[model samples]
Target chain A: MILLEEVWRTFQVGEAEVGALKGISLAIRRGDHVALVGPSGSGKSTLLHILGCLDRPTRGRYLFEERDTGSLSELERSALRQSRIGFVFQFFHLLSRLTAAGNVELPMMFAGVAPEERRTRAQEALRSVGLAHRAKHRPDQLSGGERQRVAIARAVVMGPSLLLADEPTGNLDRASSREVMELLERMNADGLTLVVVTHDPDIARRARRVIRLSDGTMEEEAP
Target chain B: MRAPDLLRFAAGALSGHRLRTLLSVAGVGVGVAAVVSLTALGEGARQYVVNEFTSLGSNLLIVMPGRVETTGSIPFGGVTHDLTLEDFQALVGRIYLIRSAAPLAVGSETLRHGDLGRTIPILGTTASYAEVRHLEMASGSFLPRRDPEEAGNEIVLGTKVARELFGGENPLGKLVRMGVWRFRVVGVAAPKGRSLLGFDMDDAAFVPVRTVMQAFDRRTLFRILLEVRSRGEMEQAKREVVRLLAERHHTQDVTVITQDAVLSAFSAILNALTLALAGIAAISLAVAGVGIMNVMLVSVSERRAEVGLLKALGATDGQVLAAFLAEASLLTGAGGLAGLGAGLAAVKILTAVYPAFPASPPAWAVGASLAVSVLVGLTFGLWPAYRATRLDPVNALMRR
Candidate 1:
């Protein structure tokens, strides 16, 4: 479902040219559960950003569904990201002013869903996450696990084919982390291609495929 | 998102920061209120002046002595007393369109009634002066229509003069002494308050014009008040007056002023003043606009994470810009309405406190204030909304 051919990403910090991702090549088929694992400064987040179409590569090609994403205009890229890809941040990133249902309905709003349908689908998504009773609660009012569940519901509300989670349980306690991981695993098992970037070995070992990076270059890939 | 949804979202975002939203709204409100109330004052002043002029009677003309229009060739030392009682007589008998003519002779004299003495301005005119100038009588009769010499010894006391001289007792038929003449008060004038030039019309007395001329040893009338048959005849009457006066005096040494000319000139000056006042008040609205801009910029910076999240959820830069602009427009629109209500209340209070003040704000002023507020919001809100659009989604989220 996604392919990267010798992709490179560099940053100009002051007078120094810092290569965040150097000569990386990878591929992942549909319905695959992949974990991108690396230490700090290893370009794990940067690589995930590239995969999610949130950042552009400095060199080479990024193909999603056999279409080159590098040549797409900014508007076209935004549309592609909207309809096909979903992102879950470690912080959950739920709008503090909006209720859980509002957060779940946001992606569909961007997708131009009818208001009545959006309301119904938002409630359904919340129900799937076991947060239907808390749908009217704001993110700050919810527990850490509940907030993450809201974020997950929001991510899947648009029915995207690809889901990218960056340390989705980084701020959660052990039990909450396990619940979030199991929720993600269940979604992946239902055939939504999931790519998780994490430092947790337990979470990484549960993935069907693992890619490790060091010093901005891929060091190992285990199937 | 749909337009309604976008508005809803923006409103929700603004409501979350209640104090900031209120302050911005108040800024716009004060601006609109300033515009509304100041224009009301200006418009009120204009209406007051127009009302005063209309109350002085319509289709009236004043023929004053002196050549107001001077030619360089006419030379100096060419002063002339061009208006007289004869000219007034000519208009009464000769001019076909002249409805009435009142010759006026004014003087200041001390009036004595028993032990009380007061200095009062005296208007010297015929009986027609009352009808021509729209002056009402309180009791008895106005300068009686009779031989000038016989009417000369009788006087009509104004309301204030009668009040001061006789207290509550009827002053009619009472004797009052003016200078060397002992006059019998035949009538009391109704209260006319203050006329133009700060002269209290209610604090004076009226006598036959010949009486004043004879007492003051001056045959020249101060002014001749001419009443035209209708408003349509005013221009023709003025032309005939100039011709008749020029023929009588052997020179056009007179100025004929139509009520309309004076009214138009006053209206022009008052209109300009009203515009200037409104312009000065509009500046406050601009200051309020700057306040909106400041608040919007702060709001943009504070909501960087939300902006990033929206972008990540696939909102275009255009969508974000539209959202913020909508928010700004909503703030200003609501504030403008509130300000309009406040301004109307203020005008009402002012009119209530001072019943004589016109204090009615014009309709265009209200509409204009509202339009300007929305425009100010859009103009001031650009930079912050642009900043929001330019934020990179990934970097914004990573900023923590």
Candidate 2:
């Protein structure tokens, strides 16, 4: 569940203030499959960052599960992200030094899970992503599809309520992209709320809800 | 994170860049090694000097002929007046605390026996020189305290001088020629080891003070060595001796030095020298700390993606900061251990090469060196670790 009341984000570049998001308002209930589609410079990533609690809305209220997120301290926001929200970046963002299981276990490690349980749960998460056989592989050792799957396992290892993926399949080939998209869709079908930001038309069409942004504001939405 | 896991993660991070990590560690290692080894050398020199002085004798006082003055180019204020046998006799008789006093009259002589002859330092002192100097006799008896007229022809050879002049044969009662005078060797003194100050007890011969004064035709004694009854009586004995000498001679020209004063002064100078050595060595440690900071800064910039990934995995700013700091400490701690081994090995080699060199490392120096390395890690690591915490996860990830 997410709610925004005319949220605005502005950036200062040199001497001018650039509006990344201009008075945008939106809401999505739990278990919803939503796609935010936009061309370059349309503030898609910025909005995703705000939704994931990595950034605060510059002007306006952002309420998650009926609680005002803007009122929380930085520490509290980090804790909220730690326990309740997950993020998937376009480039996978897996630490190259860590194995697939190590990457998957990182979220639970920060959550203070015991080593034995972290191992077991990380293995389970990898299994769910169909990457159990490659649990020991590092990011560089894995294919693009496998790396994205590993990133997904890491995102969901903490059992967050919402998953925010920003162009998760951007670096993958078409076949690997289909596999990753299918995996995300299956996760959504299992009732974990999913919000995917993508410029791919196929991904936008498959989502239960599609929101299009032309500039900083939403131009249209298919309910 | 759990403590073990945190450490594991830090170790993993350091292991990622093997060469960089090793170079930084080597920097710290060299610093610690320099500090430990240099301080050990200073400490060893201090101990050596202390041992040398201690060997001179305990509760001993020397009455030099001149008073030390604070002002002027000359350190001693008074004119060079000769301390006589009467001054030595009077100190022994008047000062109740004076256990014994020996008059020293030193000169160089060509000591000869048969065809063998060598130039050696010869000491002219009373029979009390044996007890006052704590000198042991290796063979035969020491020169007896007889009427100065009767014992004028007796001399005691030092261990090495006796061996050089007489080979393995006993030199006791054998006649040895000194200058134009022939004297009987009454005893051979035990070997006292050489000192860095160039005083070697085994290399000199001792004769009766009257014999030296008569032989050299010198009326003045070189110095008066006073042995106190106990360490506690040294100050009182010195005051009494000085008072008696000045009162009788009507001149305050004598400088009285107790063993404690010399020992304390030497200890103070050497302590400061050791501290200075350690300070100079600590500069190298500071340079090593800069190296750690440099590498850590480079690592921070290079690992932006990893830092971003951690944050995206729900790590807080504090966690990221702690991770980097932990990584630094791990490097320095390992480096310190390696340095400890290296420094100790160097000390061992030095001691082995020079058997008499006391190259033992002090415990506090070792502990402080290790502690300082860890502290350097924490101090120099702060900037890079702080920078990691300030990274915006969204931007950092996007940069990747």
Candidate 3:
């Protein structure tokens, strides 16, 4: 469960205060698959960042699982992000030096998991994302879709409750994009909540519910 | 994050930039090597001085006629009572700690053998001088044992003196005249080079103490050297000798000091020399630290996106800083090890090439250089690591 009431995210651009997300109120149930769709500067990524606890809202009450994130200290916020939230970037951001398994082992590593268990769990996560055979390959050695799958495995390796993905398949071909979406949908069906930010209408349609944003405010929501 | 994982992550990032890593490693390596090798030379010099002092006789104590710290009768009195032959004889008979004694009656004079004449320092000492000072004879025997007050005609030529006078044709039994006395050369001292006492032992001639006193018309003995049975008895012996001399002279007019005192002074000087060398070498290490800082800054800037990605994966700011710091430490740590090997190898080669110097690294120097290397890594790596952690994760992630 997530809640954001009257959230205003702003940035200081030189002398002017620019609002990235203005007065956004939204809610979603557990295990919900939601898509945030907008034009280039419509605050979709900012909203995703706030929801993932990477950034706090300027003025809002944003709560996750009944805990108000605004009240948490920096360390507590990081702990909350580590234990309950995962993020996937558009770039697939895999450390080029690491194999797919090593990439998946990262979050658990930051979570202080032991190396042996990290290896085992990372391998299992990689297998679940259909990257079992590609676990030994680095990001550069994998195809675009396989890289996204590896990123997805890394995201979910810690078994976080919420996964926020920004343009997960932005660089993939149509076939590879569909494969990545199906992989994410399968995880959601297994009761992992998913929130994706994208400009692609097709990817947005695949979500169980969609939220549209214009400028800095939420425009509409569709079932 | 676990420490090992953090190190692994940092190591992996370093491996991504092989040339950069190698350059910084080399930078620190050279600094450590300088520290190790220079300290080796410094330590070697100190040990050499120590060995020289030990060879001069560890238990030897000298009784100078006048106290260096005091003047006789408030600067307007007659010269301090000279150390007399009677004083030497009395100390020899009474001090049970005196294993051997060398009564010196020193004077400089020109000596003539046939048509050759050269001015050389003359040392007048008793027969026990050779045994106490560990002097080796090039040929013939030393001055015969006689009463300290009796003048003898026997003489000993130094290596250089004999070479200058006799030209290797065997100076034994040859007569040398000094200030009107023709003394027969009974022995020649072997080449002993320079003693640490600042005198060239190879360039001085020896005769009986009474001979120099009689020939030079000197009324007092130059000094008395008392060799103790063991080092442990020096302090007690010095006190007893000073007490006996004060009773005889009615004043403590002599300075009695053990060879250990002079040795310690030399050791202190040489130790400071070694420390100074280490300090100079440490400057190089700091310069290398600056190099490490520069390279690490570039590495941090280059890996900006990775920092953001790490934060997104739940790495805290401390974790990011630690990761980068680990990378810097790894660079300098490996460099320190490599430099240690290189420096020790250099010292080994130097020792092999010149065995006389005994070049080698001291344990403290080795420890300090290694510790300083890693400390340099931490100190210089701090700023870059801080920069990495301060990066805004959102802006960093936005960079594709």
Best by TM-score: 3
Model 3, runs deviating above 4 Å: A221-223, B69-79, B194-199
Once superposed on the true structure, which residue ranges of model 2 sit more than 4 Å away at CA? B64-101, B105-122, B136-142, B145-150, B157-181, B187-205, B213-222, B228-255
Q: Chain A alone, model 2, TM-score?
A: 0.98
Error of 3 at B184 (Å): 2.2
**Residue B359's C-alpha lDDT in candidate 2?**
74
lDDT for B305 in candidate 2 is 79
Chain B TM-score in each of the candidates? 0.89, 0.83, 0.94
lDDT score of residue A109 within candidate 2:
87
Candidate 2 achieves a global lDDT of 0.86
Candidate 3, position B280, lDDT: 92
Interface CA RMSD, all predictions: 1.1, 1.1, 0.9
TM-score: the better of candidates 2 and 3: 3
Candidate 1 similarity to native, TM-score: 0.90
- Give the CAPRI class of candidate 3: medium
Ranking of models by lDDT:
3, 1, 2
**Clash-forming residue pairs, model 2:** none
Please give the lDDT score at residue A149 for candidate 2.
94
